[model samples]
Target: MTEVRVGDLAQGFLFRRQAVQLRTELSARGQELSTGRAADLTDRLSGDTARLAALDREVALAATLRRNQAQAANRSAAMQAALGRVQSATEPLATTLRSAAAGGLAGELAAAGSAARGAFEDTVGALNQSTAGRSLFAGAATTGPALAGADAMLDTLRAEIGAETEAAGVAQIVEDWFAPGGGFDSSGYLGADSPASPVPLGGGDQAALDIRADAPALRQVLAASALATLAADAALNLPEDTVRALFDTAAEGLGSAGPQLIGLRADLGAEEARIERAGARIEASAGGARRARASLIEVDGYEAATRMEALSQKLESLYAVTARLSRLTLLETIR
Candidate 1:
């Protein structure tokens, strides 16, 4: 028979080493139990991190998409509000101009025209509004205001109209200037001609903020506003008939522009709904991805707790043995 002999010092050292190992395992198991995460991720994932990595990436991508979608929603909301402001700015002027024209009251028409000029300035401010430090109606040019100042635009219009006393000629020139590839495009609008790129809202969804200051609807409103301003200009010294003609044209333009601007608001509202749905989808997908990742990486809390209890007991036994060895005396050894 072969006998394996260990000295007291070496035996105690062995027990201490075993206790240290048990303590480390016990601590790891307790952490798993408390945190619900595997202390040994390499073991939990079987050393193949590709699936977990993919899930983590999905979570990150979803977060990014949600952020972008939120920003797009904000931009859309701002545009809707700005459009509403512009509509308010135009509607009252329409009523006023229509009334003045019907009554052929030159004094009332002039007062309304002056009011229209202020409203036009207000409209420009509304369209140039920014949200989150970005222009709401500037298309891709988020950094700058969407349109030139009202004064600048009126100056350009005045230059183009150039002492034209006829309402028909003034209207024609204003329309031409506000048309595509015209003076408004070159100077009045400071935004991009091309619309902004669609924001990705995850799950293959996209939302766009493409409404610009130079839109036809806005152009019509602004053109009408210019006519009203011209009508008010005592500097022009126009006849009552011509002023009435300008008032009628301006009123008509405002009347038609209301529907166009409303249509634009409806389109933006639709996009807002699309973004909201995409956000819901993104959150759902992200939740599923997170749960899937958790399934692989998270510890089974009951199992971890059980293992921790067993390890604790084993460590306690080791400490007891180590203590007994330390307390050994010559009489006790003999006994």
Candidate 2:
């Protein structure tokens, strides 16, 4: 059996080690109380780094998807408003043209011409509309206007139909210019060939972010408007029947385009709905992911505070014991 010594080298070494451990624990607990996160994640997590990394990735992906969904929803809504404007401008002109064709009254024809010019300008402006500095109808050409000016597009059509005497000839010329590889195609359209890419909603979902100004329904509206414009021109010197024929064709074309235009609007509305739903889901998932991440790394406040108090008392006791040991001498110890 051996007697234990109070002020030996072994006792001094044990006290110093205990003091160092207490100080480290106090520092860690203090950090946890202030920051609400584990001071030593590796030790707190039991070295399970892979799970922590996976959780971090989940939170990041959800955040990115939420941002993307918001952008897509805004773009889609803008497209809908732009299309509605175009429809509003073009729709009434059809009824006006039909009235002019039936009556052939000078007053009605004059009103028709003025209305045609206004609609042409408005349609061109609508096609060139932008949202947040991005072209709404330029397909993939997001930075620039989707079409040339109203005067330019009309002038090109007028040049193509130049001096054509008969309705058949004028109609053919209109076809050549408005059809693919024609005058309007060559010089009128200013947008890119490829449309803007779809935006991601979430979970591999995507939404069409734009509608090209050169879409078939829109092209039909422009072409029909051009025909009305030519008939209304005071310079062209078109015969009475020819003017009537042109207006009739324009009115008929617009009537057909109304449904197709509405269909395009419907498509955009559907996409808007999808984006809204995706946004809600992403928000929910993001909240869940964030909570999971906090659970993984955050420390309990009550536990940290209690542990700090205990460590403080232990440190004080170690300090007093060490001080007593340092003061003790060999003579006093032997006595």
Candidate 3:
């Protein structure tokens, strides 16, 4: 039997154990390096990217909504401003009419009637107004003025006035002028008796205006101005006191619509406030979504660095042990 050298046995045992330990360490390191957790993070990052894209789309929509809201607000403001001018024109006419009713000078009364006529013309001009080269009352007809021609509209009004004069006397004509369907229809064109089918702007059948068809203040103001124009013309034939009475009636009609306009303005203001609040909410929501997406995809640099250092240390220890085992020899140990 061959003699078993202690050095040989010790060296064999030590080398085998070292080899086993190194294998175990290498396997652990390989498992650490090949963690499926990284793949999971990558998948999560892809999901984040998808979510971010959706948020971006929402943000873009919000921006568009904001622009639309701003345009609406501007149009509402312009309408209100027109209403203000109507109110200004009516006040003095009302005072003059009241004085005439109390029995005043005929010349002064006729002058007031003339002023009222001019004011009615101005108000009508305001109704057929434009902004940014687009007619506000054209209802989807954006290219040009809502009416075919100013002269044609005046002729239509004059014809209506003539018909009213024939049927019932000047007072009845004045009354008919202030009737509900007095001015251009909802589509901002003459003979728009039906609220639903407003006249198209620029001689087309396309409704371009966005003003509500049933806007009470706008409707009332249009009627009042028409009545005022008729009253002014009738004043030419009547005594000062009778002329004043008609003028007073027309002014009162205009005044009656003033409060309604104020209410509409308030409503528009509230809508503006709501739009602002919605915009802020959208912005906040988008920011939160972006942050959440970043958290899901972003890697922690410090943690990654620490894990790499630990893996390197483990590998180095394994290498040192392997070198020591290789140098072990029975002849060197026996000496």
For lDDT, the strongest prediction is 1
Q: Which candidate model has the greater lDDT, 2 or 3? A: 2
lDDT per residue, candidate 3, 137-156, as tens digits?
A: 55565555544443444455
Q: Where does candidate 2 stray beyond 4 Å?
A: 1-20, 165-168, 237-241, 312-335
Model 1 C-alpha RMSD to native: 3.1
Q: Predict model 2's lDDT versus the native.
A: 0.85
Relative to the true structure, how large is the alpha-carbon lDDT of every model? 0.86, 0.85, 0.55
Best by TM-score: 1
For model 2, how does the per-residue alpha-carbon lDDT over 75-151 read when each residue is reduced to its tens digit?
88888888888899999999999999897687788778778788878888988988789898998889999999999
What order do you get sorting by TM-score, best first?
A: 1, 2, 3
Rank by lDDT, highest first. Answer: 1, 2, 3
Candidate 1 vs candidate 3: the lDDT winner is 1
Q: Candidate 1 residues 1-335, lDDT tens each?
A: 43345775688678878988998899899889889999998887789989989999998998898799789878888888999999988889988888888875666977888888987998899999999998888888889999999989888888787878887988888889888888999899999877878888866678977888888999999989888887777777777888888889998999999999999989989998998888788889889999999998998878888899899888888888888877767679899
CA RMSD per model (angstroms): 3.1, 4.3, 11.9
